[model samples]
Target: MEAATRMSGYRRHFSDADNEFEEENEAEEEYLDDPGNSSTSIDHVSSGAVINSITSKSSQSKKQSSIQQNSNQTLIKEALLRGQKLATNSREHARLTKSVTYWLAKDSQPEYAIEKPGFKRMLKAFAPRYELPGRNYFSRTAIPTLFSETYDKLKRTFSSTEVSFFSATTDLWTSCAKDPFLSYTVHYITPEWQLRSACLCTHYIVEDHTGENLKESLLEILDEWGLDAEKQVAITTDSGSNIKLACRLLRWTRLSCFGHNLDLAISKGLRDYSIEEVLQVCRQVIAKFSQSWKKTRDLAKSQAENDLPAHKLKTDCTTRWGSTYDMIARISEQQRSICVVLATD
Candidate 1:
C-alpha cells in the first residue's frame, strides 16, 4: 500500500507535465549529490513541472474537499429522514420506542427520555420533525405494554418441557414508601445443563401476611407461568415462620436463603464493641459529606486537587451482607482525599 501510494503520487506528478518527467529525474539525481546547488539547478530544468505539480495538488485537494462536503450533507439528510421515520409511529418506530423504554427500565431511569430536555434535544437535533412521547405516555401506556410482552415471553420461555424442575425464591419486603410487596424469582436448569434464574414477578400484597395467602399467591404465579407444581424443587427464603408455614402448606421443599443466613452471621460478628465504635465513626464521617451537596462538592474538589479518584463514600446497609466491606474499602482508598477535605474544612 505504501509503494502504491508513492506510485500514485508519481503518476499525479507526470500527468501534469509529460515533457518534464526526464528533467525531473535528472534534477532528483543532482539534488541527492549536492542539495545546496540542486534547488537553483532544478528551477532551471523545469519550473513548469513545479507550477503544474502545485496546480494539480490544489485542484485535487479542492475536488476531494467538495466530495467530502457533499458526502457529509447526504449523510445529514439521510439521518434526518431516519429521525423523521422514528417519529412517524410505524412498526419500526414502535420497536425503537419499546427499546428505549426497556433501556430506561433496565437502568432504573424512570423518565429520562421523557422528562430530560437535553435527551429530547439530542433526539430533536437528529430528527426535528419527530415528536417524543411524554412521561404520562410511558407511565400509562408504554411501560405496561412492555411489561405484558416481557411477561408473556418469560412464560413461554419457562414453559418448555425441557425444564424438569424449578426452585422458587420469594421475599416480602416493605418499600421506602412503606408499601408491602412480594417478589418471586425462579431458578431452573435447562436441558443443556446450564443453570438460569429469572425474576417471575413483584406485586403488591395488600392482604395481611399469612401462610395460606402466600401459598395461594405462589400457586397462582406457578400456574400462570405453566410451571409444574409437582416438579418443584425447593422454595428458598429467609428463615421466617410465615414463609416456612407457606412452604409446608404447599408441600414444597423448603431451604433457608444462604445469603440471608450469611448476612445474619456477619451482622452478629460486627456487633463487637470495637467494630461498632469504628463503624459509628465511619458512618459519621461519610454522613458529614454525603448528607449535604456542598460537602460532597468540596470533597470532589479535594479529590481532584489531590490527584485521587472522585469516588463518593458508600454508606453500608445493615441488612446487606458485604456492604460494610465495600464501604470500608472505598473509605480506605479515598483516605488521603478525605483527609485533605477535612484539613481544608
Candidate 2:
C-alpha cells in the first residue's frame, strides 16, 4: 500500500531524469505517513454505556498491549536479520561495485528508492557506515563481529596448516563500466598457494588519467592499506606507462607482465602489418552474423552445413595489467585459433 502510493506520488512530482530523483524521495516519506489512516487510528475512543465501555476498554487495552509486545519482538528480529545481511552484503557490494562506480554524489537531495541516483546514494550510505548496528532492526555486528566471523571461517578452512603473512599484489584500472573513476586491487597468496585478489579500495581523484595522478593514487592506496613498499619485494605490470610509474612510486622491483607483453606484441605487430585491415573485414563478418536473429540462425545453419569450425573469442577477466603470466596463459590456451586469425592470408 505504501509502495503503491509512493509510486503514484513519484510519477506526479518526479521532474527530470537527473533533477527529480531527490524530490521523489520526499514523496515517499509523505506517502508513508498516510494522513487518513493516522486520524482513523486515533478517532475511535469507544464512548458507550458505563459498564459496557469499561469492559470493552479493558479488553481493548489488553489486546493492544499484546500486539505491541509482539510487534516489538518482530521489529527486533527483523532488525537483527537485516543487520547481519547488511554486513555480509556491504563488503561484497564494495568489492564488486568499486570496479564500475567509484565516485558518489555527496550531499545531494535524497530520492525515492526506485530512482536510479537515489538508489545509488542509498547503497553508498552503507559503504561508510558498516561500523555497528544498534537500532531496533538488527543486533550489533560491526567490524569486530565481521572479522571474528572471517577468522573462524579461515581457521577451519585451513586446519591442516598454520597461516602466515600473505604475499600481496596491487593494481589500478579504470573500469569500462565507467561509473567508478579508479579501481585498486590487492591480491593475497594464501598458505594453500591459491591467489586471491580483492578490491582494497577505489578512488575518484578526478577524470583524467595522468602520471602524477597515478603516482598519487598508488601512494594513497598503500598508505590507506598500511602496506610497506620495502616488504613488497616485487610488483608486476603490463606495458602501461602509468602502471610503471605506480610501481616506481612504490619502489618495488617491477616484474614485467610477460604474458600480456607477448599478446600486445602480437597485436601491435599485426597492426603494423596487414592484420589491421583484415580485422575490419572480420568485424564486418561478425556483424553479418549478429545483425539480426534471422541472420544469426542462418549463419549457424550455414556453418553446420559447411563443417566450418565455430569461432569463439578468448576472455581473461582475471588478467591484470601486471599479469604477464596470465596474459601468456590466456594466449597459449587459444594459440591455435589466435594464430589462424593473425596469420590469415
Candidate 3:
C-alpha cells in the first residue's frame, strides 16, 4: 500500500507543473492579440532595417566622392604640367627670345654672352623649364632678323610723306684702329611737330678724305636712303677745311656748328701762359693720383675728413675743351682734400 501511495504523489506533482505552463502560454497569446503591441514590434524591425540601409549607402557615397576628388586633382596637376611645357614651344618662348636679342643688341654684348654659365644660371633662376638656344642661333638667325626688321621700319618712317624736308649734319673721325669713318645724321619735324633725328650712315672711307671723295660718299648715302637732294634744307659741319670744301662742292646750304666755334675759342683762350701753366700742373697731379693707388686711397681719406664729395680727379682730353673744363671744375671742387693728401705724402 505504501508503494501505491508514492506513485500517486508523483502524478499530482506533474499535474501542477502542467497547469503553470498553460497559464504562461495563455498570457503570451493575449499580449500578441493586442493591435498596438503587434504594430510596435513590426515598426521597430522596419526602422532598424531602413537605418542600416541608409548608413551603408552613405558610407559608399563618401568613398566614391573621395576617389573622384583624387582623380580630379590628378587631372589638374597633369594639365598644369602640360601648360608649362607648352610655354617653352609657343609664343612665350618666341617673346622671351626676342627680348633677349633686343637686350644683347642694345648693350652691344658679344653673342657668346648667352652661353656663359653665370648667364644661364641667372636665366634658369627666372625660368627653370625654358631651354636656351646656342650662341650660333643668335648670331646667325636672331640678330640678323632683328637688324632687318629695324632697318625696314626705319626706312619706312624716313620715306613717309610726313617727312617733307630735313637738315643733315656730317662729321669725320678716325677710330682707335686708325680707320677713317664719316657719319651723317638727319633731323626733321614729324607731322605731330615732334623733333626726330636719325643717323643715316657711317661709311668707312678707304680712299683719301678729299672734298670730292666726301661729296661722292654723301651722295651715295643719300641715294641709298632714297633721300632727294632737293628735299635737304641744309648741312651743318665743323669748320674743317676739307669738310668746308665738301659743302661748297655739294652746292647746298651749309652752316657752321656753333659748338665747334666755341671749342676753338676756348682752346685759344687757354693758351695764355699763366692759364696753360696751371692746367699743366693740374694734369700732372691727376696723372700722379691715377698711377699710385696709395695716393688715391689717401685722397679718399682726406676727402672724408674734410666732408668733401668723393669725386675722382678727371683727366682732360686735348681735343675737347669741355673735358678740360670738367677736369678743372673737379680739381677746384676737391682742392682742400687734394692739399691735405699731398701734405701728408
Candidate 4:
C-alpha cells in the first residue's frame, strides 16, 4: 500500500512538471502575439517562428514533452555512467596498489614508489584517485612482507626431491661509496628440463673481506633459506683470493669464472708496446675532446660535413678489457672527424 502511494506521488510530480512547461510555452506565444510586443514579432518572424499558430496547442505540448523526456533520459544515462566509474575505481584501487608495489620490488625501484614527477604524472593519468605509496612505507613494511611471502613460495618450489641439487654464483663488489656488497644467484633445472636462474639475495658486507667472514655470511644465508650445502653442485666466482679461500674452507667445489679468465687473457695479450702506443693516442684524443664542449661540438660538425653519423667516443675501463676494445673501435670509426677537429685547432 505504501509503494502504491509513492508511485502515485511520482506520477503527480511529473504531471505537474509537464503542465507547467506547457503553460510557459502558451504564455510565451500569447506575449509574442500581443500588440504591445509587435516590435519583437519581426525578430521572431525572422527566426522562422511558428508562434503555435501553425500547430495546435496540444501538438506543441506533445513536442515540448518529448524534448523534456529526452533530457531526462540523458540525465539518467549520465548518472549511471558516473556510478559505474566510481564503482570500477573503488574495485581497481587495491589491485593497482598491489601491482605497483610488486613492480617496484621486482625492478628494484623502491625510490620510484615515492612521489616523483614522472611517477606522479603516470599515476594521475592511469589512476587519479589512488595515492602513491611512500618509499618508507614500501621499505619498512611492504617489501618485508612481500619478501616473507615470496620466501615461502620459493621454499615450496625448492622442497621437491627433483630439485635436490642447485648451483650458485657469488660476487663481491665495492660500490662507488666504497661499501662492499655480496650477491648470490641460484641456478637449477626444473622437472621439465628448463633451465632457470634467480638472484637469491644481495646484502651489505659489513665485515672485512676475509675468507672466514665470507664463509660465515654464506653459511648464515644458506641456513636461513633452508638450503642444503650437501646438495650444492658447485660455486663459481671470480679469482678473488678471499672468495677462493672461502669456498675451500666450506669444502664446496669451487670454479673460477670462465668470463673473468677470458677477460684476463685478453688484457694480457693487448699489453704489447705498439698496441699500447696506439691505444694511448686514441685515449688522449678522446679525453681532450670529451673535456671541452667546443671541441665536442666541432667534432660533431665535422662528422656531419663528412656525411657520417655523429657518435661519441667511449671511455675505456682499465678493469674491463671489453670496454677498452669498444673504446678503440669507436675511436677508429670516428677517426676522420677527430682528425678534422684536431687540424682546425
Where is model 2 more than 4 Å wrong at Cα?
A: 1-168, 187-197, 304-345
Better-scoring candidate (TM-score), 3 or 4 = 3
lDDT of 3 by residue, 1-345 (tens): 998999999899999899999999998788789987998878888999999999999999999999999999999997676556436558878888898999899898999899889999998777665678788999999999998898888789878897899999999998889899999999999989999998877899999889999999999999888898999999999999988888899898999999989999999899999999999999999998999999999999999999999999998997765999999999999999989888876
Worst window of 10 by summed lDDT in candidate 3: 80-89
Compare the candidates by lDDT and give the number of the best one. Answer: 3
Off-target runs (Cα >4 Å) in candidate 4 are 1-91, 110-113
Write down the lDDT of every candidate, Cα atoms only: 0.83, 0.54, 0.90, 0.84
Better of 1 and 3 by lDDT: 3
Candidate RMSDs in order: 13.5, 28.9, 16.7, 13.9
TM-scores, each model vs. reference: 0.65, 0.41, 0.75, 0.73
Q: Please tell me which predicted candidate would have the highest TM-score against the true structure.
A: 3
Question: What is the clash count of model 2?
Answer: 16
| Clashing pairs for predicted structure model 3, backbone only | none
Clashing pairs in 4: none
Give stretches of model 3 more than 4 Å off. Answer: 1-89
lDDT of model number 1? 0.83
Ranking by TM-score, best first? 3, 4, 1, 2
Tens-place lDDT digits, model 2, residues 1-345: 999999988876654554666668887567558986665544443333566888999999999999999999999987776665445457664453332222221222222222366555765575543332222212132333444555466445333343233334444555667554556555556767887655555677564566677777777766766555555556666667877776676565778867777777755565654655655554554444344565445544544555555543222223434343443454445445443443432
Decreasing lDDT order of the candidates: 3, 4, 1, 2
Q: Mark the 10 consecutive residues where model 4 has the least summed lDDT.
A: 80-89
